[model samples]
Target: MGFEEDALLAESGLIIAPDPESARLTRTITGTDQTGAARDIRIVEERPLTIFLNSREIVTTMTIGDFPDYLALGFLKNQGMLRPGENVTAIDYDDELETIVVRTDQPTDFEEKLAKKTRTSGCAVGTVFGDMMEGLEGLTLPATPVRTSWLYALARTINTMPSLYLEAGAIHGTVLCREDRPLVYMEDVGRHNAVDKVAGYMVATGTDAADKILYTTGRLTSEMVIKTALMGIPVLASRSGFTAWGVEIARDVGLTLIGRMRGERFMCVSGEERLVRDADPAAVAAEDPRSRRKGSRD
Candidate 1:
């Protein structure tokens, strides 16, 4: 399936349990209302998704259903677990077991790789520490210069992206792109999982890191930031916001952190140099209507 299709699949996560307090709510006509005919009920569902690396179960995440294969692959890539050319061969769902199995041919040294200490991360990536930070710090990203205008446009298009969010308004989404075009859009109960699916899709299709961009609907936590940096996407955009750590890591790694992208406004908190800044001296005057601003961050 394609991006929207994959996202739809991921959004179908299982509802594992119901809270007695919450389950008690129901919509019913009430005399207090003007029309006295409106009521609403709410319930939450959780699905168990297992990501397998070369048949070895690497991780399990609770997410709303849909893109199992992409979620698995994206998770691995961002976790610094996936390497180049480790194509995922198959994705199978055992309905009876209610778990997804992802198959890949990538070679791994799990015992050795997992030796590092772990730190708390947001979402299903509960804990991640780059024990291999030395090697990871050397990740070479291609010089894919994206303008601030393109960032603004991508953020704009992402708002209107077709997915369960637009259809159901109950899922998180992640989009993978090449310059102006959106290549993949994955959605799940969790934003991390959605991005993971995109990572998996990129690996399966041999998409290069230097040629892609990542977009999400969730806040730019450290995990999300690290994932985008690892994927070599110089810029990561989100509709939500970012944490202090997220901004810090992006600054250190030379990645751009763009958040609060909605309507016609956004904040470029870090890596402003990568963005296409206004060059017109007269426009600068219009921007400040005061002192002449410096042309560069000198």
Candidate 2:
């Protein structure tokens, strides 16, 4: 490997990184290219995962089959079905049936909440049940000051990390980072699923989000903003662009929202006051062309 690859490998010592080589996560298929030459390419595998809270069957999500436990807990937590500090007695996953059941100590019911499902703009058609906005009524993220040096370091490290998105064309990634180090990296067909996995990991491991930053390889939408704020994460940065409501909500909740983070450039649309501009942008190395992922050009 070259010096750049070696540096990338050294920086990608995440607690949970992508497993692109997993046979269950990808499939090879033959197809013809532009020149009509035969080619075999690997594509990500999407499977239906039905999540149940107690006896109540929640929404069925299409995801890249991995980390079903985290996905389930995160989904329910984000949807307001699982409140914080709720006693989760057991979490059972039956891969053969493609189902995961989360049992809580208290009896649970969300029949009416499930009836008011709102379809989000996330890929694979993400659904939010029962007033996702209500969760933000009294929500305020910590005014955590983020250093520009940390942001630059995180962007360079995460962009060059080996991931399923670099392996397959269709995927989104969300990384949980502290300062300049990436901790858990999760990818899925939908960006929502990826974020949920990160959230689940936080909940499962009891990791605090107040001092952390979230990096995504997806657009900054309202759903993304809400989830990050609800998780109590102060900063959300993306290599892509943003939506109007996403910026508005981030500003309202004191959450730092930075987007269009490529190479030595980044735009902080919300919580700009929290950023300590300690890094000289000109001194930072430009993003390597070969490290660019899918949809980065958009």
Candidate 3:
């Protein structure tokens, strides 16, 4: 199936753009099963996602479309380009070129921020760590923990979620939730951009992540871990996997990390105590303790 391009939101909830002109493209075909029997394809859209800083073009990203604003803020946060307390002055979109302008309190120096580009297993983007430890301290999140058992449940349920990924297989999905129920489900070509969309949507709708759970379809990377931490979300889950630094950061900030969530099982790389595990009722009720209940990993 061909991937769909994004268009402006109309009266309806969904919109598709007109056939665009020729542009550069990139992709990688992934083998899903260990036996190489199962196959899943990935079409990477490394298109330019430009962000203008206070009306001046500062960055252009090769990413998928949804959540451009959140992607912008996430970019600024990592570069130490913006502070959490700084109110976003304005956001303007240019439909013609698909460019976004992000306005903030004061002008910033883009050169120094760009010098910290680092490569990842996924991609070589950029990163910065000035005052990161101090910044983590400023986040005041709710004491409520996202139970680990709930992590398994939520991870399973997320696969069956009503999201764009279920419709468009090419896109990576990002969701923001409170406990078990998800509120925002956004999709993009890049996992990073999907996350940014959640942040942007939450910001636009005045939703707080203090007690929320952030879920993604992509592997948990250090960039994602920090983004969720800055948003004040206590938990992060992914059906895929995680990088070493991603787990370390989550542990340092007292964050719960759940991954490889298949139906009833999940890998708890950090904050395992947060899960509330209970015996399977069907199994306990029956003679066999191994009697498993049927479930769909959403």
Give TM-scores for every candidate, taking all chains together and pairing residue i with residue i.
0.71, 0.94, 0.70
Q: Give the Cα lDDT of each candidate.
A: 0.61, 0.87, 0.61
Candidate 3 stretches with Cα past 4 Å from truth are: 1-46, 123-143, 279-298
Candidate 1: tens digits of C-alpha lDDT, residues 38-120: 64533334577666666566766886655565666677667667656566566777755766666667666676555664654
Candidate 2 per-residue C-alpha lDDT over 1-298 given as tens digits, one digit per residue, 9 for 90 to 100: 2223423442465357558888799999999999999999999999999999999888789999898988998998888888756888889999999999999987887788888988998877788998869689978889999999999999888888888888876999899888988878889999999999988877766777888999998989999999999999999999999999999999999999998888899999999999999999999998898888644675
Residue by residue across 29-103, what tens digits does model 3's lDDT show?
Answer: 667687768775545455577888785666677765544666776666544567657777887767569798888
Count: clashes, candidate 2? 0
lDDT of 1 at 284: 22
